[model samples]
Target: MLLVDHVTKIFDPGSISEKVALKNVDLFLNEGDFVTVIGGNGAGKSSLLNAIAGKFFINDGRILIDDIEITNMPEFKRAQWIGRVFQDPMMGTAGNMTIEENLSIAIRRGKNRTLNWGINRNEKSVFEKHLSELELGLEERMKTKVGLLSGGQRQALTLLMATIKKPRLLLLDEHTAALDPSTGKKVMEVTKKLIADGGLTVLMVTHNMKDALEFGNRTIMMQEGAIIADIPLEEKKTMKIENLIQLFEKKSHTPFANDRMLLN
Candidate 1:
């Protein structure tokens, strides 16, 4: 459903501090494919997602979503085609908006605004059903302001908002990183259920090696802005933490070098 072709992004081009964030990176995700991305610092994981989301234009190369070229599209325009959940829980929703209000916005994605009624009975029932699956009691508190929620609760709500429209592609940028381990695991569980239930395509960036292995149909390891290894689910299931480290070292020839990642 998504394709990136030989994309490259260089920051501060021709300047002394020029840093190559992405170097001819290419990847493709078929419909319903859930791919987990892993890499150390400076691996261009975020840059790659940003490039596809059209946060900014790449210096060269093309980004296509279902055969529609969007390499140069603006971020707001791309919002209709892609859904993103960020590492920071605070980013994906309006803190002051009530739960129902926030969901009302997501439900209207990719559509022109109308003078229609908002948050009526039908929509409320749909939101309630979706929230009930999170098992977080959010369905009972639909009138509460989102800012009143805990990080995990807010993130759970954001996950729902992002997928309400069954976006063509889902981008998760270390979305569960800020939560405690148990909470993060729960969030990942919810993520898996949603993906399967909708047959959605997803690309999730994560620092935890185990999550990278356990959660997706494919695992991709990046280094210096390019994919060094792409392991299919069958091969990935047989991979231990040690095996992954070895493969990363062999491919990047420098060992996956994040202290936090190793300690985790």
Candidate 2:
């Protein structure tokens, strides 16, 4: 459902400080495919996601979502087919809005707004049903302001909001990295459940090696702005952590330098 062909992204081109964030990067994802991305610092993992999300125009090549070229599509325009959650818990939702109000906005994503009642009982019921699935008791607090909730709670709500209407693709940019272990695990569980329930296509960037291997159907390793290894589910199932380290070292010709990834 997604294709990135020979894409390149350079910051400060033609200058001494030019940094190639993405170097002719090529990637593809099928419908319902959940891929986890792992990389050391400056490996273009987030850049890859950003390129797909249309955060900035690529220097060259093409990007397509479900066969439609979106390389030059504005980020807001691409929201019709894309849903993303950033690393910061505070990035996805309006903190001052009530939980239900926030959900109302998500429900209306990519749709024309009109003069009407804010949220009907049926919509509230649906939101409650979805919130209940998180098992975080948010269903009972729909009227509460999002800013008052804990970080993990807010992130979980953001995940729900992002997926309320199934977009063609979901981009998870280390959505769990800022949370504590147990809370992160909870959010991951919710993520898996929602993705599976909707058969969603997903690309998630994560620094935690164990989470990378455990969550997605495919795992990709990046280095120096390009993909170095792509491990399919069957291979990843048999792949040991030690073997993965060895593979990265062999492929990149350098030891993996992300201590947070290794320690996780």
Candidate 3:
């Protein structure tokens, strides 16, 4: 389970530029829950994700994973239990490294390093098995440098690396936002397969309303640092983009004004 208890974050507190990014937000996710978050700019969607991931300290409240307190843990320390995929394809992987080398590091996350050669036949076979699931023929490019892969391929590989060890929580920060439409759909398919296969708990932030409704078990809408609406799978299945916009306006008591979100 994952918990965000009364969490709040403020930037430049008590100054003219002060901004409240999160406002005593409380969210709980059960095991294997896949929730998609949607919001306009400055709605604190990414702030919530960064807070849970320990990218920065929350000004108040606590964060816990499976009953263990991690509120004060450094980002690197928290990484053991958290797997993240960023929006930019280049941010998640080591471009200069070979695909196998990158996977090797991910598989060894939170483990002590040894002087032994990084890849053994057994590990290679495991890598091939995982890469084959992407069905992008990445297994054949194991020895190739990751920098040469296309944006979608690299994002797919990053997704694989993030869940290879079955992290307790996965944070996907608009991970498919950078891909072309077709490529993005392909990546989403792979994402669904992996989540089901691993029974992974995921929190995905997305701007695409169609994706928000289509992909996850539940959808949450944020506005000005608070979750104003949460629709479960049954409700979401029947909701269209127009209905979602109406619902957002009704819950937020304001017009939906984010042009980028509407355009997507």
Candidate 4:
């Protein structure tokens, strides 16, 4: 359902500080495929997500979603087929808006807006149903402002909002990185439930190796802007974190150096 062909992205080209964020990277995802991404700092993990999301135009190559080329499409235009949750909990929703109001916006994404009545009983019921699945009692607080919720609560809500309409692809850019470990685990559970329920195609970038291995059908390791390893489902199922670390060291010709990833 997604194809990234020979993609390359370079920042500050022709300057002394030139850096390559993506190095002719190519990736493909079948429908309902969930892939987790792991890499050290500046490994192009987030850059890959950004390129796919059209945060900036790539220097070269093509990106397609559901077989339609979106290489040059603007970010807002690509929203029709993509849903993304950012690293920051505050990035995805309107803090001042009520929970139901935020959900109303999410449901209307990529659709023409009207000045009709804000949210009907049916819509509220739908919101309640979805929020109830989070098991966070948010269904009873639909009228409460999002800003008043806890970080984990808000991130869970963001996950729901991102998948409420089941876009063709979901990009999770280290969505749980900012939460406490316990809350992060809770959000990850919500994320898994949502993806499974929707049969969603997902690309999740995470620093936690165990989470990377445990959550997705496939796990990919990146280094210096290139994909060094792509472990498929069967292989991933039998592999331990220590095995993954060994593989990384083998492929990258360097010790696994990211202390944050290692500690996680």
Going through the candidates in the order shown, the clash numbers are: 0, 0, 0, 0
- Give all candidates' CA lDDT scores: 0.91, 0.92, 0.93, 0.93
In the range 1-264, model 3's lDDT, one tens digit per residue, is: 999999999989999999999999999998989999999989999999999998999999999999999999999999999999999999889999999999999998888767564699999999999999899999999999999999999999999999999999999989999999999999999999999999999999999998998888999999999999989889988989999999999999999877768445
C-alpha positional error of residue 189 in candidate 3 after TM-score superposition, expressed in Å = 0.8
Span of ten consecutive residues with least summed lDDT in model 3? 255-264
Q: What is the lDDT of residue 158 in candidate 1?
A: 95
Q: How close is candidate 4 to the true structure, as a TM-score?
A: 0.98
Model 1 residue runs over 4 Å out of place are 262-264
Candidate 3 stretches with Cα past 4 Å from truth are: 262-264
